[model samples]
Target: MQPTILAALAFLVFGVTVGSVKIVNQGNEALVERLGRYNRKLRPGLNLIVPLMENVVLEESLKERVLDTEPQEAITQDSLAVLVDAVIYWRILELERTFYAVEDIETALKNLVLTALRSQIGMMKLEETYASRGQINQALLQQLDGATATWGVKVTRVEVQQITPSRAMLESLEAQRAAENKRKADVSEAEGTVESIQRIAKALKEQPNSQTVLQYLLAQRYVEANLSLGQSANSKVIFMNPKDLTEGIADFIGGDEPNGGGDGEGPKPT
Candidate 1:
């Protein structure tokens, strides 16, 4: 009977020693609640507590954590829709407040980030959103850091990952850009045609026989046109009369010379 009592006492002592010891790893913290109330915090390494009364309610890493949010649809100031997503880097500063202040820290932080992102995007045009990534990130960091301060969270960095437009919006932008380019091309071609006509008229007025000079230019243009058609791989060449091209030039040059009217007639008295 004596030997059996000694063995029972040894087992009890061993059980108490094991239950009182708590081992916490590096870069981690644990909160202890005594009898279902606030008690104390346990840092990294071995800690001692009352075996049954004190409970380790929370134990989490204090290191930086990353939160990557899903892509969210938002509207710009110009009323264009865009898909925006981001990455956040943050960590807990005070474990006590972090555990008690917010019921769900991660969910609350994510919602705050989404709200702030939409607000910032809503204030800028779609074009500005594409060009202002750094500005957006900095603004988010400032807003989130301040907002989460009470929750014992420190937002270290924020990054806007991607801002993408819908397929329809992309197509519309392409069409707009193409129309602008075509307009510029048309203006340039019209200007070139005007300059060429002015130069041709000036040269013809200086010639003694403007009709002959105009005829020669018409013939040259006809030859060049035929040559271009012959060089084209897919062209079906068709011959045109050079004389038909000369009539338009003839009318253009017939009016007057630099010195006087080509008809050698003075102005008639009314």
Candidate 2:
């Protein structure tokens, strides 16, 4: 063969060889089509195809990916508008179906999620929506997985990141929570007071010096009741005569003592 002819043939052979090989990276896939018809899938690593006959129509990742959905306003069963944002975990399962069956996978997956979310939220009240995040996530996962099955996508997980009520609704919820807490506190305080009264009554019935103890307890409570009055920076204290206090104490205990010197008639004026 002539040297120039040999060089031209060698170059053509090199071009043909180069065009026949396809290398797909790890965690990736490619779809091949032959003359406008589905041929086969090109998996990860080196693949061979007929030069000028087969074409790689699409390349897609096989690894799991996250899809963050934009916040969407959805109405609850109670007619409250809630803004919801979510994340979807998914990946392509079949490259051929992914490329041919779904026109736009991301857009489709997101829209499907939004629709399913709205539908689920619509069936529940605002409180239920807030409280049922796990249920909502599971519901979304199930719906998305089922719907995307035909599109060659596998939805592994779904998460509801945020569910925000409107300003007025939020304020109402806060008020409701506060009122509930207050009611609980009041009930607890009332229970404690009742328990204290019962214990005191039992002690009085069982003890021989109950009357004297009761009188002392009453006096102590009276002092404590007025203790807050003396906490102010400008608080004033009035001195009462000890003689009058002694008389009052006797009167309060219904005693005229000397041996019962103080008359038990009534309290003496301070």
Candidate 3:
């Protein structure tokens, strides 16, 4: 009878020990409840509980967690349809609220993020969304942080993974860019031609005595014209020495006689 009582007492002690124990993992916190009411939170490492009156309700991870959201359809201010995807980085800051206040923290967070993204996207144009990804990310983080504060979740960062426009919009943008580029090229070409002509005219005006330059240019034009005639037999040919022609024209216009007397007639008559 004495051995039986000793063995029963040992079994009771083991059962109490097993039922009153709790272990919290690293970077985690365990919420303890007593008599179905709010109670203290257990920090990382081993903790004790009352055998039957106290209960371990929930465990909250303190480590940063990544939540990748599904791609959502959004419309821009410019009436463009876009598909946007993003990710959120968060962690539980207050273990008590995280475990007790929110029924489903992860789902609530995801919904909050989606709502914020749609609001932000709706306010921006398609081009703005693409160009201002940083702004979008910041806006998302701020909005999510505000919404999750009550749930004890801290949003560390939010990042936009991709923003894609519809096929029709992309094609329209490409066409617009191509047209702009072509217009620029044409304007540049026209400007270059105008500059070349102006430079040539200025050179000609500055050097009025440049008959040699004029003759060279004329000869080049003649050669090009002849080549373009393509073996035509009826092409007319005109030829003259530029220096002689220029001197003759100057003497005629100035009413000046030739330098040398012809046949010595001038000396005899005088």
lDDT to native, each model: 0.89, 0.84, 0.80
Q: Could you give the candidate ranking by lDDT, starting with the highest? A: 1, 2, 3
Model 2 Cα lDDT, one tens digit per residue, 152-179: 9899999999999867778888999999
Error of 2 at 145 (Å): 1.6
> Per-residue lDDT for 228-264 in model 1, tens only?
8999899998787777657655655656422333465
Candidate 2, which segments miss by more than 4 Å at Cα? Answer: 167-270
Which pairs of residues collide in model 1? Answer: none
**TM-score for each candidate, following the candidate numbering:** 0.69, 0.62, 0.62
Q: Which ten residues in a row have the lowest lDDT in candidate 2?
A: 252-261
Q: 45-92, model 3: which lDDT tens digit per residue?
A: 888999789998888779999999899888899888888888889998
Ranked by TM-score, top first: 1, 2, 3
All candidates: CA RMSD in angstroms? 5.2, 8.5, 11.0
TM-score of 2: 0.62
Better of 1 and 2 by lDDT: 1
